[model samples]
Target: MKKGENTRKHIISKAAELFNQKGYAGSSMSDITELTGIKKGGIYRHFASKDEIALEAYNYAGSIVGGHIQEAIRQQETAFGKLLSYLRVYVNVVEEPPFIGGCPLLNAAVECDDGHPILRQRAQQGLEGTLGNIKAIIMQGIESGEFKADIDVDALATFTLSIMEGSVMMSKLEGDNRHVRMNIENFSAYLRAVCVQN
Candidate 1:
């Protein structure tokens, strides 16, 4: 990569960690400079404003987490396996997150709501993408005869995302992975029960 591109990525990487951990409002230009060792003028050389950095950082964080989940899903052979893999990824996130903070989508959504419209919209897009992936997996399972035909893909996808996000939040707040693990186990059981018998 070019020198300027490398600097831009460095800024985004450092800024993403700060934003994910301290949040957009909590993280300032000084914090970014301190974390990245880049001057305010240098940061501005790449990003026009803090909002621009926040948006890019949000996208960067989302990509990191999303790529991790996608890789896990790709390793599975079946839709049911992929679904379980998806749940397992979130469970793992409670212990070893892809980013410094927990789920970026949840963090950004909570922090940006009613404050930063752009960041909030980005978070929403990340969530919708996740929901779409889950729904697609369930649809695949149904078409492949692995899951019951009567199952509600949209509702289940929403439920799965909600449970995982809530569990992650609870676990992060309490500094315990039990909540996430238990919820994931329960979700896995639900999937197995719903799956068609071979």
Candidate 2:
């Protein structure tokens, strides 16, 4: 990569964790500089404003989590296994997060809901993408005769995502992983019960 590209990526990597942890509104230019060891001029030369950086940082963080989940899903052979792998990723996140903070989508959605339109839209896209993935898995399972045909894919995907996100929030707030594990265990059971017998 070129020098400028490297510098830009460096800024995004450093700022992603800060934004995910402190949030867009909470993380300041000085914080970015401190974290990245880049001066205000350096950061500005790459990003026009903090909002630009925040958006990129949010994308970067989301991509990391997304990549990890995709990899995990790929490791499973069956659709039911893939779905469980998806949930397992988040359960693991509650114990050992891939990034510094928790789920970037949840954080950005909560923090940017009222103020930052761009960030909120980005978060919305991330969430929609996640729902799409889950829906695809459910559809695949149905086609393969692994899941019931009558299942509501859209509603189930939304509910599953909601449960995972809620579990993450609760775990983060209480600094405990028990509730997250419990939720995942229950979700796994639900998946097993819903799966068609071979």
- Give each model a TM-score: 0.95, 0.95
lDDT of 1 by residue, 39-156 (tens): 9999999999999999999889889988988998899978877876655776656568767898889999999889999888888888889999999998988898888898888998
Question: How well does candidate 1 match the true structure in TM-score terms?
Answer: 0.95
Q: List, residue by residue over 45-97, the lDDT tens digit for candidate 2.
A: 99999999998999999999888889988899888778766557767565588
Error of 2 at 178 (Å): 1.1
lDDT of candidates 1 onward, in order = 0.86, 0.87
Compared with the true structure, the alpha-carbon lDDT of candidate 1 equals 0.86
Q: Which residue runs of candidate 2 sit more than 4 Å off their true CA positions?
A: 195-198
Model 2 lDDT, residue 50, Cα: 96
For model 1, where is the 10-residue window of minimal lDDT?
86-95
